[model samples]
Target chain A: MRAEPQSFDRVLSSMCTEPHPAAREAAERFLATNPGDPGTYPTVADLEDDAVSLLGEIAGLDEPAGYVASGGTEANVQAVRIARERAENGRPTVVLPESAHFSFQKAADLLDVELRVVPTTDDGRADLEAVRACVNEDTAAVVGVAGSTEYGRVDPIPELGEIADSVDALLHVDAAWGGFVLPFTDYEWHFGHAPVDTMAIDPHKMGQAAVPAGGLLARSSDLLDELAVETPYLESTSQATLTGTRSGAGVASAVAAIEELWPDGYRDQYVRSQNNAKWLASKLESRGYDVVEPALPLVAASVPTPLFEALRDEGWRLSRTGDGELRVVCMPHVTRDGLESFVADVDRLETRVGLEVAGASE
Target chain B: MRAEPQSFDRVLSSMCTEPHPAAREAAERFLATNPGDPGTYPTVADLEDDAVSLLGEIAGLDEPAGYVASGGTEANVQAVRIARERAENGRPTVVLPESAHFSFQKAADLLDVELRVVPTTDDGRADLEAVRACVNEDTAAVVGVAGSTEYGRVDPIPELGEIADSVDALLHVDAAWGGFVLPFTDYEWHFGHAPVDTMAIDPHKMGQAAVPAGGLLARSSDLLDELAVETPYLESTSQATLTGTRSGAGVASAVAAIEELWPDGYRDQYVRSQNNAKWLASKLESRGYDVVEPALPLVAASVPTPLFEALRDEGWRLSRTGDGELRVVCMPHVTRDGLESFVADVDRLETRVGLEVAGASE
Candidate 1:
């Protein structure tokens, strides 16, 4: 019946982390405000605009158009809805990589769009040839991933954009986790790098904002106009948001987090997280386990299931890929010492079980 | 970029109010946790279960199946989606009253369903005969408004349920603003009163929880299973929520608020709010304005546009019904003193404008 929170010490697999101090304070201050009714809560509503602009700065759009969404799911769904709304073809279809998040499946079912899930390359990136083969006149959108969920892999976004252009379809980049860190890396993603018509980014993931601080940015305001619905009773005449009467806490905390940690703070944090991921990957590799390279502060290793479960029993929050690789996300809350302790637990479990070297096969 | 909130002093038209003290503290304590990932944050996830159970007690559902939503719009949209999924007919249609919130319009558009909006009776309730006539085999759902937005009027829900039964459609009650107070009233509009299949009730509205505390409940768990989608990476195999990675703050606050003020506190608050509404209506009527009877702590007066604008100009945050009647809602924050101040502003605006008795036309 009580909802007290535990510390984020063992939360290695979850994408969410402890919120930045400024985000927590800002969210508390605006807990009562409703951003959906912009006229009544002008400050929080204006903060939403500011959050979008900040996301644009991170996503490489000088003149961005978006709103703070409930989360990555809502943002992803809205992007598909926009593509479906603006498509000129009959029975709108969407082509995405196999590495795309499961939210696209939800979007396809809700919007009644044909989803063409193409295969990924051996390196875990989307295969451009398969994407090209799948896209046609009916394609409403082509999706590229900046950071895959199971493994950190960025797709060939510029090529995907080219394919989308060939079919007169929009290219949507799902940078929900990579957006804050990709700005520091030399990744060819986001609006500034290519013709990405839409993007989904989350402030709560790497920007250290509170939960529900997800962003959906567009190349122009016209793209958002396709999602607009008339709201007769609010201060604004029309609303493009998927949900009505949203909490302003997310909007305010998004701006607060961005203002407090834009380029410099996020740059340092990304460096630290990337270093932790590299350390963990090296540790696992030294133990004769095949480790996926740290693409963007995420590590996946082929650990045996018994050993993985044993480590989990030691109070580590962990998850696995569909392909049975143990996944660890080096979020802002994850530290080098935490990974060392995790490795220690794995070593102890291996010594106790006298396990076979199945990880070497990967 | 500053998101400092203004006080809710002049706000009389909004359904939301300032959070209760316990709710605010609980929200702050659990700001970063995600109830969507129940495996990672079990405490907050369990709190969501508790919140749904509390809402069931209030909605008269013995065994409720529901989850905390982002807001009422998401809950309402999900209700329509469930009906569409469970329906055996092709090209789903929905029958709703003109008094339904605009979220249904957004839902119909998103779900590719035809919306048949019927007229309302003179007392502002949905016309039962019109609703009965609109039901057909293609109708996926029938919507009844327990408390309408413009004028708080409860529909003939039992009759509407019967009409929906004839077509094998689900009946959804939108009690987003009425659930917290309806228990104190004699309205037969809940699951115990009728065969209500699904309901959209928000804790953020009159329950005095923070924003984003919307609830969606069903009579049985089978109804919610219709909206379930597979989640590959999480501990839970499936999720029925509209948005993923939601802030646990909403669920925690909803439980805290309901625990702090369920029967005793909300009943007293409703009595005071209803009394204030009656007093305001009498005062406006004495000044030659045609006021709608205080049906459920909401008042609508046929005030002249100029006078309404004048009152707004005098720093009274107000809105009007579609028919140009000044609308005011008695939220938890609205008090008799606040109503006195609003009336004083109305009197001064009338005197300054030297307006004629235009409201007497009604």
Candidate 2:
């Protein structure tokens, strides 16, 4: 006997969203290309340059020095590594909000840098006072989150930047989820408005590109140049990337996705997803669920563990927050109809629970 | 008017070989799949498992614990990180041969591990006496290269393994290029013959898979478990990868390539490439070039700087050795006809140089 192979289409419960149709098409078109060793394939390298330029424009940098990395983890790791190298302090430390992505922890461990995790406020945003208190003379970087993983709350970046400046620490913004959508929204969380020295942004998350299309942008080339290491065996003189022999398919797809969505295409899609999130939140709230007001496309609500398990068994994919709240992210593949059907199922479960309580009381 | 995008097929001078047709087909089949966040797509994750299993079998490891990483650099970094964590020493150091890949330099920098680079012998293999002298109680890992980047030389892995065992330090084998070719040859570099604790292998190299298909295999699951980190917001509890939200295309392509070339397919291809390399080496030697006998499929030869530049001008893509020798890697795409044409051009240039010298003397 053999087990049935899992289907790609059946994944509905992932926070890492699916690639857009155009992104998929782009990846398929460049399946044979590799951008890692750039000597043979200059085209993919050019595409990476274009993608990085477009990402810099979106993030409000004039001319950024960056590359399309593997994902947010690599980008964040690179950002921290740059800070560690640039800092003159003997003991390097990085300050981060409690809501920062787990990649920071990984970076802290891998780079052997001290991590000072500050708690978030009641509203699920980074505490500005806590960040200020955490920074010291040895602080290398102060990390702020935009579109946090659990609640999707943007940190107070302008204030954090000021705190970092007081101690001469580099400010790095983790905008892996917000870099795509926030540019079109009313939110002020880009490098243009904030004093961010470096940033980690992911086109795969909200730009609707294929998976693994993440970028680490530096305000100046000098910061990135500090990380370059010589490669004597290859044609290239030096490489600054954390990984060698990367796939160019991600860069190609990201370029194609950005070209299709640039100027206004992504804005329209964001508007749709944002509206869907708000609509879903309202539907849940009306049914007696405590829903968090969405800053982006994610909505968090409290639910029993049994209900969560039931939902999973029903083939509806979902995630949970650190405080044990159910999280629903409204990506392009998650439609309004799908949310409505999910709401109906929740309503039925609530009604059954109410009847069971009534019978027990009798 | 806009500039025309460069064609992917036009690249000819890259050591990064083109993807196999079967690998391309597999990638196209799962363009919309992501194996990292597996709740939504389980098939790609299963494909990753299958690919790792196949790689383990090729590396002579049974039921190896590992994942398909982004590339050789990531795999090497992860291996070093694991060694660093598992070591009980207060100050950790990694010893490597001078011919080891540049990724070790990166891992040492990223992980803050002390690197001891021992010089190689005249024949381009690691000097075991120097390596033994470098190892100490603080040494966490002793690295051996199966196929060096520039010279295609294999280090004495069995001897290195014995030295590592005596010191209780982990022995990691970097077989990124040789893992696919050496198994088919008479080389004793795999886990079956050598006492390797961990190994870094790349399917994108000679396995004919797409780029980004690098694997880090461990002798025991305990060593790999040390590198796992928890992701609170994700569906899975913890992730062992260096990059978060990686692409499944690499894993799928690797699996497809392995299935297509299993048992005897890769062996036949290796023999053909080996013959091609030997023929090219003879041709270069006949033309008065000091060519090194290829241990694998790479031919490194001394050529005049002017002639090397002229070959590049004629659109012949090649690499350079550390000692300024020309390197020609006979990959699957670099056919006998291609090598013959390259040799003819070199022959023409040599005749022209001889005539110029004669004219000057007259």
Candidate 3:
């Protein structure tokens, strides 16, 4: 019922809270066994390899090729940086869908590159025509969104890959939200299948992991060469991340999360989340609400404006996207019963939005 | 024995294996909460005001001024970015002690600023004269190391402040390893009396909090104007940090750690760490090991090159500095007996390095 932090303190605290246990344990363990960096006890290298093995299991990547990063934003930013560095230098431009995450924009801004947005179809899929048109000799990379921030839709990755190949540009998939989920979903074959040159995954999201925890996995080892900054204290090996001194706790937690889920457990969890989402969508539509269907477990509904405020007053939290559509991200924790309660609450508030759903529904 | 992970895997399973019950409970409580873009449901404003009120019972700031970051590296980076942004366009350079944390160099490199290193005195503290010689009109910021990474030496902050004032540059203190310790030690007054404009504090390091946790406290709220970035999804508030999508779990854990560790509790922790450090230093010194003295909870020792390798062969882990000095960072969990064993092992390895006691003949 209270207001959120509009300032820096609120944002920072929020970020820190997600990985508290993992980070705390990491710090305590590091202090307990290897109190100082001066010692040769379980070095960060051992931790790195351990994390890589665990992540490899989760993503189903064969060679354990990847690096840890602070967050999805940094991972995305690093991918952009790598692409720019590999650019021919005369012109550098990154092509991304209009529905791509804001981090793509941030990365382009940080690297001082031009950002070209490709239009998306009405169903929230990438417009392949627009994407092909956007690519040229100056194109450094093409970013396709898996689970876009606006519509929670997965772009046609294989089609985009072909487009990128035609232009001789890198294909980066901003899979921050859906990277771990796709591995367990019906679309398991879609991931890393279409020659996604680089992908960013956040364990904190549907991976059900901690925060400040995300990674970028590249198919080619050469991708990391662009970000390699050799230094005395922080050295870059074949495997390197965007920033140094990352929360080992985050990495450890991610490793643990993946180990717990392994192969079958995680796949089952995604199925449950998807089922829950489908059920919620069906119930909402039956109640006469305009629900976006075949949704990627993310439901964006359009109801009368007044009813939205009524639901908020009833203690239900829903986010509105840029086009004034309310969105609900079906997290792993969102339960079936909880969905029912949410639907019922919406039904009650429907009258306020000038809807007569009980008898005149659908 | 198999190495334990940095901490319990909070993502995979909602389980707790931490030794401290309070910390474990705090972690669980934090995981249950989530913040939205404005960050998690309770909102960061509410959490910050709550944390400020809770910690205010300890060393409460007069005004609500400060930003939370992920550990000392990020805190230092953010502070450096602030200084650089506020500097005259053509004159953006940072000067710090040679003994400062490698993170400073990283921050400068990432921000694309010139870094000038000032030599340290024999006492391991920053040389004020060297600092003055290095600073000129082009210098954007002067960084003072409190509990430097290599030698764990505290710079003369007050004296360094004078040099920064002369150069008309901002003075930033990297107190990541010692911030929590200083507040409760004999140096309590030093922090309040120092002329530092900004400081990086790591709750995870000396505060014994979780990892990926840190704070950047500046003397004035006006200093934060530089780290601002404007985007459609994220609005840069007065206290925004480096990245977005912060995890609320981390913030709650830090707040809990700070609130739980009252002044007296922190004082006890500091005393214990310092005692362990003193005992180790004294034992090493008696063995005629080339040891740096007057170090806080962190002590550095130099062994003959061969002896260092011999100790590594024996499975003792230690950190080496740029100059090949091995460091020991005593913490909450280190025991007196363990310190004695470490010293004895080092003494044995000294013979392997072909270094005999100077007064062996006597």
Candidate 4:
């Protein structure tokens, strides 16, 4: 038998929330349309164009040339491919901070580009000095994370952009998790940074769109055109995307979600989500957990692995950082009551451990 | 405003029918689930595994190592990546017929693999003599198409397999549009042909699953393992896929669609669709259009560009061959009445064009 629809109320580590009702309806509305082969259905092509333009606006680009990819991985891979193609040097390399997502490694492996990993600072942000030392004439792109996957800390993109300019390398900001929220916040993570050339943003993550709604935005259409390959068989003259025959439902849902959340709805949700993360961090700190103050809506706390496993066993969905830190992402679906109940469980576990220690000491 | 749900009843150029109702329900049922990062929801992962296994069975594999990809592009790309990695040569090259899907070109661009395109025969089948001449010690893979996208012709996969074996090169069959039908047909396009190492099959094309449901099947688990990259930040230990954070809806929908169509449903639909294509081909030929007899459900015919454009302008969706042949794909949603009405319109256009020509001659 197939599984039932999962309840989103208890999900803590996920950047994705339950899709907005409008988004789900939009997906259902276009479930049969394949946007990749658009000649069969021109209406879907129009919706995809509108969706891409709207996402470009959200990323702070006036006229972005990009498409909604399968997810951040495909988007980032495409960004790296563009950088590789545009690089003047024979040996192409990409410089990324240690805090960058693993998709860069995947891209490096797939595209035969050299990947230079620079260490991040103690605060979990990309270290600018380290980046400068790593970048060279052969560097095709410099990658910065808008929201680091584990810690949810936005890298200093403005400084990274300046560093990229010195090397004449494209700056690709991976704003997959924070793209929807950072736009409404006072963060310098978008294309407003002068040297930013491309970005991978996912509406499915924080825009509350249905899944598989990731966009890759480029500052110039010329950069995107460099990746196009001739398709002699299809209606479209050329195809530049990483995937063939992509679903139109993702594009339609993203457009619907953005339309419903634009101007104020997203800002309101961001404020609430940020507040929830702040509240949860304080509660965990008070209970003796060494919490990392969230820059976005994700809070990472130093917790015992046994206790982490115990919490997971207790039906609470959570994730752990690479260094074994427990993380909780405050999405719109995660309610205050749910966090409180999780805190209550942590308190009980603490009490049980304390009693066991006391008995062993006696 | 968003485009309204398209009426698929009149769509003739698409191999995709309106998604099976069960497929749509399954997608909606798993809209909130993310199988890519499955630590939070294990059930969706199970569904994905089951879906992959079922698709492998359809591809004539008792035990296959694979995953559900975003579409044929990702699956074919993954197959090429596998071949490149496994090849013992320093310079890897893939040999494919000119009629292969455009995704191979995209893969060649992304993976830096030299793609050698051998010209097809007049009947739209891969030329065995040309393929034999192309294969060498440096050839990493030889690709054959189960169903040519433009002409709906099945390449001689059994002969292609023999050629690949002679060179010790991996043989990959791109059955994206034919996998669901060829098993029921007496076509030897699957793993039963021993030298076939990998296959890219799309459920969305002929399985009637919702969009974005494609699978990549490999003969051995070791081949699939070669693509795995360590993802330190996500729930999954290693990431082999082209995309991260993929939606579970595709997997669930595929599984549900397969379950609903298994045993006899697909075979019944296949017979009906094949009959429809044959009937359409006969009608087009009787009307003096040079029709290519379809091996699958696609019917390609030589129509004047003016008539083709007029048909499109009149809201009849269609695709064309690279050499400018008008094509009609008879999918499940296409009815007898729809084809009859389309033929009537074609007859009318022919008379109008004939009158214009006579008047010009006068």
Candidate 5:
């Protein structure tokens, strides 16, 4: 017999969440269709176009061109690969802040491009001066993290675009986690805001879609055309997706979720989630723990290692950041009750073990 | 609103079929889970282990070290990437036959590796001599096609293994579409057959799992370790997959399908599909059209273009090979009744428009 799937009640660190009802129904309906071969499955293919159109609207692009990638990793990797191909020069290099997601490292390894890591500001934003100093003629692309993994900080995308333009390099915004909520904020991190070449936004992350529903949006058609290869099999004449036979589950789910909740629904969700994150942050701070500001519905707190482990022992699905901080991602599934329960466990555990006596822990 | 999904009633060319009942149920249950972050979704991760174990048992491997890929494309690409990493040489090259899938081209482009394309024999199998001539000290890998896309031909695996051995290169067998059936046939195309270092066999294709259940089996754990990247986010310390945040749908479905059908159930399926392919091939031959012998459950026939268009107009979802032959893949969903309908349409079309009078149309 197969094992049961994990429950989402205690999951606090995962970027993924329980899919919406419409998304789940649509995913189940089209689970067997292959979106890679558009000719063979034109219905799902059209739905993919719908998903991209919605993503384009969300990212402030009038004429968006891209495909549904496997996930953020594939989208980010393809973005760097496109920049490298466009460079058409000597050994290419990619410049990014130290706070960039690890998937960029995967991209550098896959594309054989050199990586020039720049330091981030004290508040976790990309250090613009450091990025400017690192980017040279060899730089094929400069990355700006709209929603960093640990700190949830939005880098200066327009300034990074200027730096990339100085070297004729592309500006790829890693907005995989922030695209959904940044629109509700005053942050300038999209196509209309700057000279953005491409963006990685995932419906699976904050858009309440099923897993694998990752969006890669390009400002110009030429950027996507470079990825095309001859696909002389079915009705389609060419293919650009990394995988040959992609399931329609993610595509249909993205379309369903976007159709059900575009501007208004997502805005409400962002407000609720941001409030929950702030609530949890204040609660942690009140309990004598240092907490990062809840910038975008993600909280990072410095809890004693023993208390963190004790909470884990109490069945809280928790995780730690690269920097010894307890990370909490307020996905749609994470409710106020869940956070309250987590805090209650932390307080109970702290009382049982003398916190001052234990001191700092790993 | 999203477009409705296409029906499988007329799909004759797709490598994927309607997912098995057990597989679909499991996939729906785990649709929101992310197998890429196994530290959080341990249940589905365990199922992934179950799927890989079943794949190893079928591939004649004692211990398997691999993961569920997005599809045959990711699996094949990773196999080449592993070989290239192990090469530790400058500008590593990959030697493959003309019959290899186009996904290899994607891999070559992504990994910055040179590709030496060798020709195939008249029988559609890889020319052993051509492969031997192309492989050299710089060759990182020699590919053997267990099942060519255009033809149901299994290349000479053991001979290709010897040629790959001469250069101390890795041998990767692309059994993506053939792995499930080759076990029932007398084809030496597994870890036990030759010095096979890795294999690409998709559970989504012939194993009746949902799309994206591609498998990569390695002879040793070192091959997979070469692809690992530090994933200091969730519970798992490292991840080897090409994509991050992969859906657990594929892993759970692969495990469920394998549990339902391993040796006997798959053997029965191969017998039925192979018989269907032979029946269709003879029917086309009897109707006075040239047909390629169905070595497996795939049939290729030389059909005139106008009639092919007419058949398509009648809503018979079809495709052609790179060599312009009508390609019919007898997947588990392709019924004998469907083949009879297709044959009837072909005969009626030929009679309405004289075949010789057209003088062969494109």
Candidate 6:
């Protein structure tokens, strides 16, 4: 059945072809198994244990100090709430890059925190210098994007960490895109080891888990404790990112994905995907597209708006970036042949559509 | 494989029993079939056509408007946000029962609305009189519960509808638990009719669909229009709940469950569940436990503080209500024999764990 695209579903597809196979199996198993009588299976203790263990593994943290939610939106909401609660002076200010995900702005609006948007560089990376200038005592938390939504450019976590340290504020990382890929990458950066106090990861994205699968990993247990509010449905002992009962299948799938991908396979996949990304970017550039710099697995190209229509007419789907650029992500499932065919198709369409190429003046 | 309970997992389990037959077939089909390219999957036009057709089947509204979200929480959050935007006067006030699920409170906190906890009767149903009194010019919406979390009691909707009309406020029914059951019952209540502005239902719950499946039906299309936010990820025309790429698997499973159950099977299942609930509640009462009032398929026993330990020791898992009650729902797959065994087990554990009989003088 064809249905309208939801943001969660679109993001999942845009980021990855599918969840890890093990996650799907775990989901099937969860569906097949009964919760058992009471204390045996699917109890609150069981839930907490699963969450804590998963968070610990995903973030490489000694202790997972938070709960899972529907997705990164809820995690960001909780982070913003915590920041709002810890505001010492005037209305809390949440410092995030202008290119960060809309969830950050949504969280700020929902939590009544003043969102100070630090502009990004031309390459779509968060400008650390602007963030440093904006930081003051009124700042509750400084949010750095591990993967910028528009261009998939990661902010300088180390630089943000230094800023957060200098300001004595919490560093919350919106790593919804990179949380699953970064660990698998050869990058020398680490959000967990840095001053980043909290980070959100979505399993449905790069983790290859199902939808509604997300968890918040915290560096210090104290940050979560400060934001804790007790309700009968949600308890402090439980890390509930959202209200009501969660999707067991999603959790099982996430756990399975983590188990399948961790330390080696997932890392290898990341390296491979990154290689594919670099290759794809080179191919696109040779074809006369304006490719952005520092290309990760996800790449953005600047083109005339009409190119979007022409590409769509030629049966290619590319998400438009905020600054009128188009984005393409090289997922794990994208084969070399498929990449070649895509470039060929774009070449054919470009000739047919008769669009002016970037830097064609030269 | 046993892990802690997550909201995601709960939603998933709520939709299907372990080894759901349809899920297997769907998964098998998915494995055998290549999704090809996400872009190749029908364009926005085709999906919108299907949505329009489906909307026609639901209520034949001209120019039907809606958006897809991940779950009921997002739907309700969007509804509350829209209600705030369309509010007539003063700081917005939310009126909901204490027994109502905490999501409303979460929404209120997110939107910075003052929440007025309308009192609930001892039977766990929202007090209509109290709710009426709570509504004022400042009140934007009056939330009525269709199957409350603590007691599983459906509030007096007709009365609440009248109160909403009088106060010129919207009535939002949080049917996260009861939406699937209500339609199957012979009750002459219509949640989507006049006066009731919106209703949020989780298909994953009683619908026996997969998790991350929820819908918010509004009588007025204007509510959706008012709540719409134009983020780059989610275009307003195609969204009803939260804007994002959603899980098509959820849609697949939900449609599958509806096709398999909605006609006569769902009704029969609800009838069976109600019977089991009645039997279980009767047995518990016979064992001297104080039962919560306004009987629904779900029941809560007012257990003495010590009884929880006894039940746990006897290998029964349950949650305690805010005022120290034990809430239990008779799920679709819960057989009568299982309920009988559980009741006997609870009774045996009470005496074994040194808990005094229910209602005995302290």
Instruction: List interface RMSDs for the candidates, in order.
Output: 1.3, 3.3, 7.8, 1.3, 1.1, 6.2
* TM-score-superior candidate, 2 or 4: 4
Tens digit per residue, CA lDDT, model 4, B1-362? 44786688667778677878998899888887888887887888889889878987888788888988888888899999999998998779999999998889899999989999999999899999999998999999999999888887888998999999998899999998888888778778999755789999988888888888888999989889989999774667887788888877888888999999974988998898899899999999998889899889889999998788888878888888888998888777887889889999999988887788788999
User: What's the C-alpha lDDT at position B192 in model 3?
Assistant: 59
Q: Candidate 1, residues A22-103: lDDT per residue as tens digits? A: 9888988989998899878888888998899889988889999999998888889999999999999769999999999989
Q: Best to worst by lDDT, what's the order? A: 1, 5, 4, 2, 6, 3
* Candidate 4's DockQ: 0.74
Segments of candidate 5 deviating more than 4 angstroms = A355-362, B355-362
- Is candidate 1 or 3 superior in lDDT? 1
lDDT of 5 by residue, A1-362 (tens): 55888799999989888988999999999999999988678889998888888899999999899888888888899999899889978799999999999999898888899999999988999999999899888999999999888878999999999999999999999999898889999999999999999999999999888988898999988998877777766678877777889979999998999889888888999999999999999999998899999899999999878778887878888889998799999988999998898888888888866655555442
Evaluate every candidate with DockQ and list the scores.
Answer: 0.73, 0.57, 0.18, 0.74, 0.80, 0.30
Please write out the lDDT profile of model 3 over residues B1-362, one tens digit for every residue. 13563332111110011223344344335443433254235554356455434332333245534655666777787778778777886548999888887667656545667899888888888888899889988888899887777777888888888898998898888877777777755543133565677777765566655545566777667886565554333222222466655545455656666777757777887788788778877887777778887457777777666676576566554446567766666766565766666667766666545544444534
Chain A agreement with the truth for model 3, given as TM-score: 0.83
Residue A321 of model 6, lDDT score: 65
Would candidate 4 be rated incorrect, acceptable, medium or high by CAPRI criteria?
medium
TM-score of chain B of 3: 0.84
For each of the candidates, the C-alpha root-mean-square deviation to the true structure, in angstroms, is 2.9, 2.6, 6.4, 1.5, 2.1, 5.1
Better of 4 and 6 by lDDT: 4
Q: Give the distance in Å from residue A261's predicted Cα in candidate 3 to where it truly belongs.
A: 2.9
Write the candidate numbers in order of decreasing DockQ: 5, 4, 1, 2, 6, 3
Q: What TM-score would every model get versus the actual structure?
A: 0.97, 0.95, 0.83, 0.98, 0.98, 0.86
Among all windows of 10 consecutive residues in model 2 chain B, the one with the lowest summed lDDT is B1-10
DockQ winner between candidates 2 and 5: 5
Largest DockQ belongs to which candidate? 5
Isolated chain A TM-score, each model: 0.96, 0.94, 0.83, 0.96, 0.97, 0.86
- Residue-level lDDT tens digits of model 1 in B165-257: 999999999999998989999998899988899999999999999888999999999999988888877878999988889879999999999
lDDT of 6 by residue, A178-272 (tens): 87777755543354557778888777677777654677777767877755434563212332344444555666677777777776777787787
- Candidate 4 per-residue C-alpha lDDT over A1-362 given as tens digits, one digit per residue, 9 for 90 to 100: 45785687667878777889999999888888888878877788888899889988888888888998888888899999999999998779999988888888899989999999988899999888989998989999999899889998888899989999998999999998889889777779988655689999998888888888888899999999978998775678988888888878888899999999975888999898999999999999998889999999999999887688778888888888889899999988988899889899999977776677688999
